[model samples]
Target: MPVIVLEASDFTSPLFLVRTLEILSSCITFSLVASLEDSELNNNPSNLHFDTFRIFCMFTWCFFFTLSLLMHILSVIQFHSLIPISWKNLTMTVAVLGALMCCAASVLFPWLIMDKTVSPRPVVAAVASCLTFLAYASESFVLCTQTHEQRGYMGSMPGLLKMFQMSGGCQMIPLVVEVIRELPSGVYMWQMWVTSVSYSVCVLMSLVTLVVIICDFAGRCLLPFDRFLAGFSLMGVLLYMVATVICFTKILQLRELGQQISHESTGLVIMETVVASITLLAYTVDLAFSIKLLCDRGHA
Candidate 1:
């Protein structure tokens, strides 16, 4: 009897699958951007700022998703060089591509919901959030499967599981905020108040995740810069959350008081304006911090 060994290169390649996923992801990003612009135009005739901001958000999201797609594809290519054409790796590649596509779609929902006739943006946002959740869930599943295969089931660690959950939460909270933002106008004041509360929740989750990552990285002595970046990121999130709550509360109070008294109180109006100003300031700070953190992480 003779013994034989089969190398990874001996297996037939899955070039078509790789190419197909790349094409699909690219097409979805393009479609979502175009649709967002079209939907924005259909919604408002005078609010150019709103339209421009939506376009900007769509572009930013597309850029990130494209980068993520590239990284995933490269990872897959590298993995193929090391291992045979296993179904697990192929499935993981497909899932990553799907997740990227869903994220692209999720980011475009804000513009889609901008159309006044289409009801509040929340309806589209809710669907987008659901899709985003599904994508993260799929990624978590892949990670768990990989862990199980590499180390027997009993070898799984709590920290790894927590990291997965935290990562998923970090990706999910913004989508949740968008969903709340799109809520219908007729909802009770208390229900509308939840929008501000949701912003706080998102900020809290982001901060917690940043802290966990910071602690994890510190324990390994891998990166000190990450801690600095995470700290600033947490500050930005907190400021944004506070500003949102104040601004929304002011706006709601003004609206309710006007409805009940059929008159505008000048002091309340001034306070409302001030809150809006503070909100803008907070947003600027948050944006600056985010850009700095991203640049520091070599992601920008």
Candidate 2:
């Protein structure tokens, strides 16, 4: 009698399959980015689409996919564990770090658009700036304070806030990519307005949250404003959800708008949108976990 042996490198291992799929998806995203860059996008003021949100999305997508790609490569090389719960998986870390880079890029890209002078829309400029500030605040929170799991007084508030902002900021990249790909179609539509308004509110909420965090760090008198952060963040989540639904779906309203645009780039748009939507789930989960931590803290 012979005993059948299983190894991490065996094709039967789930990790091997997942890594293979990830590599395939990464290549797909890379191909889409490459293909779209050379084509005519509605927002390309010339051949320099890099100065717009569309380019930023493609760059961020590439960066994010590359992170996963590298993780898969490392795992493949080592014949790592097949268990899905392997400690090597850093999905949350990658998501947060990617958001950090993207928010930073958003800040710089605006200045390059339109005669290389200043960002044309004040709203975009303000939202991008505010988002950057929020990302920084969240990073500081994560770096300076202990995670809730590690026994911090604030519980997972720091981590939750960081993930929410990161996720929220990231999902916007996909929407922007899609919208820019179909530019001048629904740019001034109500849904876009809703997006702008929600982001503006998010900026205010992030500012308020930052102030609270700042006071806490300074050992100053803490305000009863923690709930305010929770409230605003909750609202942001809802608003973003509604806005995303409007953008991604082929609703009666958006249907007409999309028809006006050439569908030549539809494949690339769908690819980027799918990428964005998948990443948004990470943000949602992190947000939920953070909220749960806060609740646990309160009950304690």
Highest TM-score: give the candidate number. 2
Write candidate 1's Cα lDDT for 1-300 as tens digits. 332434465333343334334445444544544554345336554432344334444553455346546645545455434433333333343344345434534544444454443433345443544444354445535445555554221123422322232233333333333323333344334633553454455446444543544333334444564454345445545644554565466457657655443232323234333533443354345446546656777854
The C-alpha TM-scores of every prediction are 0.39, 0.43
Give residue 180's lDDT in candidate 2 (0 to 100): 55
Query: How accurate locally, in lDDT, is each candidate?
Result: 0.43, 0.48
Q: After best superposition, candidate 2 residue 191: deviation in angstroms?
A: 1.2
Per residue, candidate 2 scores C-alpha lDDT tens digits across 48-156 of 3344554564475467557656755655554334333322214334434544655544553443343432222433433443343344344334433544434332234
Error of 2 at 55 (Å): 8.6
Lowest summed lDDT across 10 adjacent residues in model 1 is found at: 153-162
TM-score of 1: 0.39
User: Which pairs of residues clash in candidate 1, taking residues 3 or more apart in a chain or in different chains?
Assistant: 122-182
Q: Positional deviation of 106 in candidate 1, in angstroms?
A: 2.6
Which parts of model 2 have CA positions greater than 4 angstroms off? 1-48, 53-99, 102-164, 170-182, 185-188, 214-226, 250-259, 263-287, 290-299
lDDT of 2: 0.48
